[model samples]
Target: MKKVLAILLAACMVVALFACGGKTDPTPSADPTPTAATTPGGEEKPTPGPTTDGVPLGKILEGDHAGREKYKIVYMCNTLAWAWNAAIADTLGKLGEPLNYEFTAWAANNDFDAYLNNIPAFANQGYQGFVLGIDDTLAQASMEACLEAGVSFVAESTTIMDKDGLCIWSSVQQAQVKNGGIAVQWLYDHWKDYWTDATLDGQKVGLIGLNYSAVSGINERKPGVEQKFAELFPDGKFFDGDLAALGTTGFSAEGGNQLSTQIYSQNPDIEKWFVVAYVDDWAIGATRAAEQQNITDKTLVVSIQADAFLAEMSNNYTGNVYVAACAVSSTEFAIDMANYLVATISGVATPETIWPEWNDAGGSYPRIQVEGTMITRDTYKDYLAKQAAMLP
Candidate 1:
């Protein structure tokens, strides 16, 4: 009861699971990159192409909603090719059955233009509400369109300009950021066990980010990693510290593999790697690249957005290279969003009442933050059990 927003968003809450600590650099050490990694058996590695086909979007959701309350809702997914987006879209598609809302989902295919185009199309079709997994580039347009159409919309995991009618819901940005730092700490905690070295002064690290284009939610995570690195090893360095080239086409396994290969070729001495991708594909790609370079044992790989499938893969992977991952369950997040949407449509909640940031008197937007689960090989089973227990 601390605030109206907290009371309304009881289901869409954020829970911080860990804190970060740091140690100063005791000695001025040399650069971390000691040597470059070579391809297996000293063979030349193939040059990676621009596109590595990522996971296909799962089957589309279709069924008869013959007798439902006929609340046509369109859920605009960020991209269907990514597993997380697909999971969310698919979950919302099915929610219409029990939730009494007609659902239709469309994939933006990671295209900003396409994302923009989808908005008016849905509005023209007379869709009542939109559940948008927003991209930073085009949120204002979408919000304006929804406003003009007199349609209610909520943003999932991303925000648009603060407007009166819109509500933004996401897992806590710090949750993702903290996981970034946690990945770094994972290596530090286990560094002695792997290297038998007393200190971790000159270890080079590699990073693969979704993109460097100032996407609000994703960009903050890189600093979280950097902050942790600086804390643990004062002046600890990344491969090149070049922010511009650190991004990828999309968070795909192909992009991950290609980027990892590129990083391996460019800075083979990187002893550890941190990846904050759009999805789990980057983790899979990096691990594959590490194995091919025959440096799986030497490198520590940590990532975020490990979906259920990839978490299972973490259990099966041979070594600890796929170190730690945070699972932001897209399906669960979608469910919570659906509940909010249902409440809003039923006249039970409004932006000003539920979102702390929304000002009833000030005419502002609403924002909700949710929590995610972290998974390691050891903790995966527990996560699975908790998820299963939720099933009817």
Candidate 2:
């Protein structure tokens, strides 16, 4: 079953590459200069589709109406404060232009009740399908509401357990695990340069974790990072930052800043940090704390969600200390998701057969895990260059 899915996924990726006009060169670097020249502000564009002359790119209909108007779908975001989330919402709305669907997004501003309330409200408006940024505690309610309304659903970033949802999509957990390994390897390679007497045995590393109680995908990533660290340096010390405590204030940049500050004060000797957060604001907050505490030169942060930190990562000052990130393109994911929902609604595929992860019998929810890109200064610059070429 897994093998069949792998072939299908590979075929999809090949199709994606060709759709984007093909891949770039074989190598990318840590330097900020791009191998290919870039057009200004064109970095990381979304996947291409039939947007020519405003003709909506609806798929060839076969089952019911062969040549009809596009369907309507709506998306609800958990919060738009995080740039990545906003980008995801925006991309979905725009991609509908070519895909023969009406796409709209609503922001819940991280309010749990607001997030829960919006689901039924959106469904009541006659949307055929919904793409949701999930809050696990409220997911069952949301799913029930959609079911009652007779709307098909697709969830992102988190999964709905034991529910009959169409699909659940998120960034690959294995890439996040590999992100931890990359963090450790980077520290090992450059330890001597940072500290003359630095040794792997007693070196302290701090982890800033995302709250993962009901969010299993993120919960799974934490152990992978920890296990890899243990494998690489058995005697190294690790400190964990309290994510629940951080949420007391809020979940925005301010909350992140306060949490990082408190963590830094408690673990003053820790020089390296690994953030198991998909939101870039948390990592940026940690860097901001490093600056305020006058430890910028002595600290390094390895994290996920690179788009929000692209500008900082490209600059020499912040770039040096920021180290690396695991990047999942919001635009690409949004495009993939929009198409998946359209395909399911159009009767081209079912939820289980849409992607491979959905076939796992033991898991309560069917899902698709998409891999991410590694972002260093050079690779980020290279990404920008490639995106520029794809324009026009």
Candidate 3:
């Protein structure tokens, strides 16, 4: 009996061992909860924070590491109140913060003396850079002052003369002469039928110029037109006889109106009147003159610089008034100049140059040439759409 009892005790021990082993190795629970690994103190290890392309947000948010310094530049225009002023200002502001620079603008409002006088004021006020859209007659003096003051200056819209290394101007637009050629071409192409008769070949075309007293660009456009007309129609004579009527007035709508009336009265039978002025203010005055004289159908009106009146003329002035404008991307050019000036001040070796070559395209200068868009009654809508897309 003792031996049998001992056997039973051994069997019971084996069964208890099997039961403990089964409990230890049982299948994982159907709804198991995952427990993260922890440190010796029972604190969970931190998961790596989210990253941008493997770079941590904290690191990416840091400021520019290139160590570029900020610069201050001053831009001077013929006038700040002009429509193009807003464009230049907008571009400069857009380029300022990104490139770490500032652009301050000063305007002379088409006053040659005022422009010349403002140079010292800007220099005294800590302006180190300048972009000049100055009167041509005064450009020599203005540029000399800029160089004397040690201010790095760039010229836009207007050309400046220098003796090789002494003067530098980065022209943003094609020469005013080229723009004048464009106007002349448009007139020849569209109005050739009007002057088709034998007597009209040598007929005179009058020019009404604004601020010819000081502004060279204004004067330059007149000659450009004459030269281009001579090239296209060698027999056509400009500013002679009935066509020789040329007048100058202030740069204002009222001035344009007053001048237009005088021109109409002086030469009523003048076949064509080319107003070398901005499309809106001057064109408006010309339209008013045509309306008052009841000669809207007989005269051909052309203008430069597209504006609200030009847009309206594109749609309405089909037979009466013809408009041609030299369209410029002033905003984009301003932005580019701002960037270049900042880069230059920051020690970038790149030099800025004019858009169109002063001579033939042999030399090296960074120039961006923008062409004017021609608008007629048929294409007014298309022009409007394009103009709208450029906004903002």
Top-lDDT structure, candidate number: 2
In model 1, which runs have C-alpha deviations exceeding 4 angstroms? 1-68, 110-114, 124-126, 162-175, 190-199, 203-216, 240-251, 269-278, 308-315, 355-364
Please give the TM-score that candidate 2 achieves against the real structure.
Answer: 0.70
Q: Provide the RMSD of all predictions against the true structure, rounded to 1 decimal.
A: 18.2, 14.4, 29.9
How many clashes in each candidate?
2, 1, 6
**Candidate 3 lDDT tens digits, 1-392:** 99999999999998764443221111100001111112212233342232222211111112351466556677777665445554565556554565565666666555678787778777787776677766656767888888788776666666565555333454444335555667768876777555444244345555454324344555555666667767876654353211112333345555566667776678755655655454335656666676777766555666555553444554465445545454444443564456445444443423433222222234444333334445555555565554434323
Worst 10 residues of 3 by lDDT: 25-34
User: What is the descending lDDT order?
Assistant: 2, 1, 3
Ranking by TM-score: 2, 1, 3
Candidate 3, residue 326: Cα displacement in angstroms equals: 2.9
Local accuracy of candidate 2 as per-residue lDDT tens digits, 16-135 = 643332111212112111111111111322322333211111122123332656777877766554566666666666656556777666666557787777677776776787887766
Provide the TM-score for each candidate, comma-separated. 0.70, 0.70, 0.63
Model 2 residue 167 lDDT score = 30
Clashes of 1: 2
Q: Candidate 3: where are CA atoms >4 Å away?
A: 1-70, 94-100, 109-128, 148-150, 163-167, 192-213, 233-237, 240-249, 271-280, 308-319, 350-370, 377-392
Off by over 4 Å in 2: 1-67, 110-117, 163-220, 248-250, 269-278, 314-319, 356-358, 362-366, 385-392
The pairs that clash in candidate 2 are 57-98
What is model 2's C-alpha RMSD? Answer: 14.4
